[model samples]
Target chain A: MTEPALGGGGLVDRHVAFVAALRGAGLPVSMAESLDATQAMAAVDLRSREQLRAAYAAAVVKRAAHRATFDRLFDLWWPPAIGDGEPIHDEGSPDAESLEEVEPADLDAIRKMLRDALRDVLLTGDDEALRRLARQAVSGLGRADNQPGRQSWFTYRVLRALSPETLMASLLEAVLAGEERGGLAEKVARQMLTERIRQFEEAVEAEVRRRLAEDRGVEAISKTAVKPLIEQVDFLRASRDEIAELRRKVYPLARRLATRLTAKRRLGRSGRLDVRRTVRASLSSGGVPLTTIHKPHKPHKPELVVLCDVSGSVAAFAHFTVLLAFALREQFAKVRVFAFVDTCDEVTSFFDHGDDVVDALARMSREADVVWFDGHSDYGHSFEVFNQKWSDAVTPKTSLLILGDARNNYRAQSVPALRSIARHARHAFWLNPEPKQYWGSGDSAATAYGDVIPMIECRNAGQLQEFVEAILPI
Target chain B: MPLFTSPDDVRTRLAATGYLADDAIATTVFLADALGKPLLVEGPAGTGKTELAKAVATAADAGLVRLQCYEGLDEARALYEWNYRKQLLRIQAAGDGQKWEETHDDIFSEEFLLPRPLLTAIRQSEPTVLLVDETDKADVEVEGLLLEVLSDFQVTVPELGTIVAIRKPFVVLTSNATRELSEALKRRCLFLHVDYPDAEREKAIVLSRVPEVPAALAEQLVRTVRTLRALELKKAPSIAESIDWARTLVALGLDTLDETVVAQTLGVVLKHASDHTRAAKELGLN
Candidate 1:
């Protein structure tokens, strides 16, 4: 009933209980570290939140192992008494003693429902049916419609939401079940599901590979053999600063073009001076004859042609780049957007003014001619198509932007086609959405492309912003 | 004074008229009494993280203070933004002659400073539950600011220096893992990962949250949600989704989840067309 003592000892008591609660909530908190945290708390001032958090974190969480868990518990246990009444401990409250027991039977039922629902989805190609089934399954288990049990059931939900494992597994189950189901409808569905799932899985794997490369770079920073920590230190600031600066650079370029056009408008290519703007400026200055004059501000409107690789490996990056192109429609006079896997398809007509970026990207992925992307990536075939059908689209004033990972799958790099296009274009810039470190590895044809045209790495949103600045005057 | 009775009696008084005692409720009570520090919970959507925050707030008999984080959120949002115009007017009204020497510091004083959620929580005298909702949605800078305030129960505004809390408020931060928080920020807090409760706990939550609904109907509702969470989809409905799904069924006067009723209410869960088609395929609706 007495007020809890607020001394050096109080800090230890708070953290000890916090760590214990963390352990109880299924986070890994060691006994040794718990003691260390308690000791450290007594030694340090608990008044500063930063100091206390660091001390507790240092004493308890090891590595990145339990960092996330520690963050959650700190918010709940310290300063804020969430999910509990009374800021201070109430020893007399018996409700604070034990945890309620988990029921295994309910969990099993939910698991079974998940399996059945997934099985139905794979067999029938019916998403609505699956949702209905899922709803029924969860409801039967004495839980709410969206809640799944902890443990494996939770895993099942994550797989469903984030990972395509469940859907792929279910599709496989359905395809296999076709032997018993019989006929052409089942056979066609199985074939379609198999092809789609394979493409999806490959795309996911490629993304994982990209992440692995980034992780490798981060790892190399600490090692004695590679770039040191100082080199890595300014990367966060450099990216933001560079993106901002790049936007500024484009503004001047656009202004110059706009001035030249306005000058031409007045002088009519006579190479003589036009005094209209000068006259207007002087009048505004009350006959003081101000030398500085105001000219028309016209935006630099260049012709743009974007060739994006819609191969499964680079599909995610391509979607975003294409969306950027659509968003940048205002600055360009004409924009030609093409998607290629093994062959190219001109999808310039798909974008309309004021179309939602997300909706457009989703539609492009669903409706774009995926024929060039079966299983293998063939840059040779793609380039051949570009030369044969879309050669006339490029012009002297056109800015050609090619976005891809540049993995040609050991096929011909088709440098001749790219060179031909570069001949007509003002500048041919290859924006590879892959790390510069991964430029030459494996099937990547980035090195070959880099030799012919200027290639810049465009990965993540920060890089995308930089790319936008480089291409368009904002 | 209340007599010491059975555990059920204590739970009933805590529940008060139709609420059921669940694991989260039990854990909150136990931890608040045992540890004396606030509990922070992180989880995927629909995992009862926010609900736990609310429940704890209710149990403590303290007012709940929430701060919702988002992109481009600045210090003025989480802490305080000064009433510059008012201060300027005050400076003007006090006459320019004596103001420079006597009231130079007064214009930028605490009177002109408006307290934000973080600062307000510190200043409030009554017990309060401060919920920093969706902390991950906030930028890394905001997260850093949060670490400074949550750890100390005080805010340091350069103009005002340090302002300590009269009473420490209960704190809970929830995240959906939008981005990785800095280790510096994470180090200052205890962490709890709340996933979707197991079927038993989920049942308890459903019943406790929606006691007016029939028990049979509640079980059916829980079972259906468990099943839906198994399929691959863009938007996996959360515990909130589950509650809505149950309510939808209850509104339709359906005792059980049938295929017909599900088709009619499919919009409540699967949002995307592809998601719907994919879910339907797996559930064998087509």
Candidate 2:
């Protein structure tokens, strides 16, 4: 029942460190919030760790996404001391007795045992036997040392012990050895076995990580341990693998953005009753006000015109920008997408065919005549094409979004064409994938365009998300 | 000046009004009351964000001033607005006797001012709970108005002077986190997130709320709900839905939550057609 060493001064110091840890985990905790939390701690009893943790969380954490990290840091600082007295087992450590019990020979025996068990399950389609074998594989091969980076090692060992390749090979042999009529059934059984084995492998991996999280803390688990890597990936310099990963995350990001925009739009519709209008209308019936009219606050969903530079220099940046625009197309009243390098062409039909963005981008690259397949980017020529043919598309209700590096290859700046488009559109914003210091260097004409349209630096997903949230009508 | 002296006091008082607050909830509520700052509660829908406000109001024996925030929630609707009709009538009744300047000041007086929930809560002599539900649904511009009111506990009317609170009301703003709130507004408040309760807590909730239901049935119902939540359904069942499911079981005179009974009453828990099909299939009800 005694207090754990923390007097009045130490309590404030502990709270300060907890706040620092939350900020380290990427939650923005300002000095004012830290002061508020210290005051909140003073109001609560430090004897109760739960009370102190709640007070600090209530004062410091703002976003729901930061709650998990806050909880982890809180538990680390204020380890519960009461009824939950279970010591850290450290059974997964190399020096532990459990490691000696799981010898290399036992692992080899487990691999063979798993292959035979899976072969029997595949032949008989026994669900119970498959579950039992999955459990055994996890227990036998999922042991780990105290090393922080050994989680994946254990995962790889478990999957290797399951021996999905040998199981598949055996199934193929059985299928080919059977008679022609029975061969078809054996093939179907082999496909089913392949799926079940894949599930079994995943189950073992999940069980190992779950146990490790219990022993070494959830922060030790790799996937959830690291913050999203895509958020920090530079858009302009992203490799093909990084681009693919970013593309996979784009739809979910777009969906979340769209949901917020939709909620704001829906809520804009209903406000207080328009009493003046209702009273005016009720004068015909002796001012009874039979039906009331609420004030209309419907938001105008702006028409979007996306001009993406698909030249070889910024093709990766354009790909992601175009994908995001099309993913969020439903939030706009109308969307027109154009890709340009040396000439401009309306590529809106690429997105209109209801295909996935990746497939649509692939098709646009193959068939769209917007770019002459020239490696050089000429802003003047593309702007001339847009001004000559697509000038009518830039109405006052449209939001013109230009995505490019704004490098002009030292060609004509075409400031007038951009100025005219900005004048015609409701709002014109240029999102440059390049950093700000390089905006006016070399052949980049970003400074000239900035004089015409406000340019925003969007070098990664985080900046791009901020721009979208700011521009989307709320 | 604190409403509750301790966290235990918050728990006991809130429990008297049918709210079973955990240690976290109780502590946060108590600290917010003590600090006299607005409590910003964010969570998934039906996780007792709004219920916390109601319970606090009941426990404090205070009048509840409810303001439902949405897009286009301006100062006129949220804080205060001049009664235009009454003002016009006053102008016509003046009969051209007074000067225009004199009459202008008269029409913008206290009698012509209509107080909204924000103003009403501040002007009250007695303690009150101001519930601003779904604050994130309101426009970003409305956050400006909230910041003005929450920071100084006052409203500025250009026609008149600023109206400060005679007695500061306890404020609770709930959001589903549809959008990120401005940092300036968030800094002026205390934050709480009410997630889905764990199985043991949820079971205790069912037992307390639906007391007529047997202990065994309540445990079974909570287990089924936990399993249903683990499935990737369109919408997960909330704490309110769990309570409703428990009530439905008790009302049907069923003492046991067997597979068939749960299958028949799944509608009370799963609202969507897709969720029903998925839960039934996953539970092997088919």
Candidate 3:
């Protein structure tokens, strides 16, 4: 029942600072949750870092999406120090000289030694040796002289130099030696080898980050090393790896959005008369309707008409928008997806009932009548074409969503064409994948469009989700 | 007030029931028990979310009341509901002389009250573990009901009155992250994310669950299951499935996990045809 005073009164300050760091990383840590975290930290053995780590994670994190960020921030704030004091290596400590003497300068020799040590760790499951090897790999191969803001780069160097991925086959072969061609065994061994390699890489990365935190202070190291959650990464600027991660998140995002929309729909209930049920129930109340129960309202799913600018720069944004709308097609009464470049075309037919999404996107790009005169993004001309072809597209029941950067190539922005569609639609919103500050710059027809339709700067999946929720009618 | 003496006690008790608790789990469980807050466990499917609730019930030697949530799960199913059919029959049986208030009072009495999982858990004076399984699968409105029940450990029927818990039950909610739970509900609970256990822990689990399986065979089976989990399969082999695989190996008296043995018994682990094909291709099995 007694709260553990973590190292004599430092736990309070440490916990507060750690929480502030988590909040800074975009994980919402409310005041009540912070108190819960403090209590959780008090409940555990304060000396055990893992116990405290679990405590903070269980208390502060409300969902699974924030766990990775929580972990990274936890590491930065509550670092694993060697002793009572933080492991500060200033004034030419023997750590440098001893590391140099123990580790070889030759990359090839260090690699060989790493391969052998890693093999031993994997085979024997020696966690102690693995941690030592991670440190060794960083000191020998990564080898940076306390450079500011270079921990990730150093970690990358260590992983590349060690190349544990290449050591997978050899390690597996070594572990399962003389055990014949066991197809499943070899396969499991290979994956196990891969798993160990990943662990080593993670350890080295964590080690480098820890050292940098010890040297440069947690604040400085944290800002540079901790990656923003993948959902927070900007769509226009996300790397291929980040994009792949974002792709994996698409279905879950769609499901959550659907759940919320369903909830929202349920809240906006207006029951209609079901005379059969009402009259049938009235017989029990002596021919008098006491409750007057109306029919359960059939959800009035809205119609959606999406015009996506699938051109050069905004293609990734459009791709995501289209895929999201595709996943949420059931929520809408009808969804007519139109893709455009210099010209416009309704690609709704491209997304057939059972077709693969990636193939459909590819076929839509290849076959759709999106290009009339040139390959340049002529949003003005595209808008006119859409206005001409799909005159009946935007009914009063429809919510119109336009996805683009609004870069009209200095061409005539046919504002009236979009204005006509917006006037007919129940709701209209334009999602610009650029920052709002850059909206009215250069050939952007953002302001012109903004006069007609509400333009939202949706830079990432997170922002996209927020914008979608807003557009869904109550 | 403590269900467990310490974090070590949590580990020991949970381990005695064939459920291993790492320091993190032990600490979180201990804190949840000490603070008298509901514990919310989130994870991928088959990582033992449901089993954790069961194991904690065993550890605490309490009665387990489980609410398996799904879409359209309403208050009538989750909480208390009046026996409407019985109420209707009672209303019909009450002839013209019966007063409205009298019939209403009789129908709303304890004899006519249908107590669901939530109401049952709250009404328990004995030690109890209330499990809301797959909490994310339930509709959002259900969460508002849960928030009220969990925060105060009480339920109200308008006809009768609010009934508070004599002894506060240990509450555990598990979710597969199908949808994000409301913040109001999450705020009342301590969160725990249980991921797939590492190879060593999984091997130990397999050994404990199916002791007839050899140590060497258990190791191989765990490694293989881990590999399948690492693959981009439709449904990865879960801890429970891994235990089943171990039992299958034991029953077959297969000690060595070799090419022929695995080829014959691959069905024991992977269920999906596509997963089988993909595993064969990825693992380079002829």
Candidate 4:
């Protein structure tokens, strides 16, 4: 809409691919945004990759939470292979690349030489040198295995080899070489030095991932390396960033799911007749019963009871499901969120303080009494605890949602306890984050639990979306 | 003429207004100008989302019309509303038995229409910057109203047909991400996320805004603010707050930011009592 494209077909192709990657990562980049991205790229200085990065980010990234994912994917796609056109390809073996840096030195000799060079670069704050050192460091130390088709690359080994912490002593000595032991300059220098070191650590991580991505293709590496699009990411395996992203999308997801539920429970409500309008119409009809006028009807909403297993691997899943349910609380008459480990406790009070879900979740873990006897999940004990504590929470008007994997930790199964609770509620369903095939595995009572309530696989947000439609209406 | 010719042009112009635009900001601003589209700027509070709009308005030497959104904001407050009292008085005075249809048309004319910020921006012949500030705070219904006016650069008054823009004002909408704005609204604009500047850019901002402060002191202040930001506080000190801190240091004639100075002037950068305590505890000031 702005102007015709200025770049060649190559740039347009790259942009389309990048946009596809972004969309697959769960960013809602629309047609107009993609067009704006193309137009934005045409307007910016293409020679500078940072400028191009900013342009694409401005055009595509809608939320702050998605920016980290965008940046990671952007690096993989458009990589800063700038100035130094392409990375040096190893001739003989992948491990032979670092040997080119020195005369076939041993591990200790390489560390000593690399450390000396790193200290100088870090002291001078040279970014280019740091990146170069990152490549060398990864090639030298980041080899976890030599197996083909397996991504054995790890950032930890490289960081461990560099041991940037050991370099900190010398760094502080140089920055505070002649100055007082502790002064304003020292405080400032320490903070700056700490950040620089962290950046170096990130550089090593990025280098390792990039090399892995280059070797095994971006799509394959992205499965293990990059955080998948928020919806496709398993709740059990989601990173902190993905969980935060899920939290941000919870409301919009709720709105979409609510629209779906509205279509299913489209009950026409007949409101109270307006007496003034009805009587005025009756006077025209010789004081007899005639036309009617009704006030706007208030539709009866459902109440929600979320019994979440806030323990072990299922914590993220339970938290997100509870958050999604509570986001739709306006559509519900009441929302009561319960948390359980070995026992049960009502954690609904944690969510009462406005929409600060992060703070509420933090407080729920710290303050809520969800643990009793060894913190191991006991499904039977928790059900009995819930029955004893809040049996009245599940009424005929309520929709009961049990969020757990039903692993049961090889403990006793309380099918009767869950069955009684399910019978009380208008609609009851169990959301197991584990896959369907893993239901009857060792230590997992999911198959047994499925007998009492319909256990559905909700491993990811996409599956949860379907389960949400199933459990919303009576 | 376009507001900006290129991304560099945006940087140069915005810098002159004492607002530094990084590559992303410069590129996004220029695109927003060249495309004649609204710019949706979202970020954490105090990252200078609002300041970007003001800087553009300053750079273009145009009028800045801000529609400060909040709960209970209605069409009468946002778009054009009829002057009901003036219309009623006109009806009472014209008791000479004018036709009802003629009176009805007369009451709804442009003469009785009161243009709010949105309409005011549209009707201006001169260049204007329409800032829909903290848009997420407003009810979702208001977005529907914004969609019609923004998409066509026109407003429909039933009394009078559609009123198109004499000159399309540069639109900038800022959000703190309290809620997600609909995709339809996001689609119409260029999206930009403004985050905290790096240490170097922040120092430049401090020196540009407060030229009175020494460069070394400005560096120290930016470093301290960055450290404070790293701490988990309820509200972090924004770029504007850092500038204010610089001005404070200059006023106090401080050459260096030692522990003594920072502890004493902590309140200058931190407002919340709890935040002060947290910062003090974290920095080991106590």
Query: Best by TM-score, which number?
Result: 3
> TM-score for every candidate vs. truth?
0.51, 0.59, 0.81, 0.76
lDDT tens digits, residues B1-286, model 1?
Answer: 1111322342454566333444333433333323324445666677767766676567556788888988657798888988766876777788856748567688787788887888888888887878888876666668778877776777888877888888877777777654545656555555555666655556776777665678877765665566666444445667777777777777777776555666677778766775676556555554
DockQ of each: 0.04, 0.22, 0.51, 0.32
**Candidate achieving higher lDDT, 2 or 3:** 3
Q: Note each model's CA RMSD in angstroms.
A: 16.1, 11.1, 5.7, 7.5
lDDT of 4 by residue, B39-121 (tens): 99987777889889999999999999999998658799999888866887889888977988899888888899999999999
* Number of backbone-clashing residue pairs for each candidate, in the order shown: 73, 0, 0, 0
- Which of the predicted structures, 2 or 4, would earn the higher lDDT when compared with the native? 4
Name the better of 2 and 4 by TM-score. 4
Model 2 off-target regions past 4 Å? A1-9, A81-256, A259-329, A332-474, B96-105
- Which 10 successive residues of model 1 chain A have the least lDDT summed? A224-233
**Which candidate do you rate higher for lDDT, 1 or 3?**
3
Cα TM-score of candidate 3: 0.81
Of the candidates shown, which would achieve the greatest lDDT relative to the real structure?
A: 4
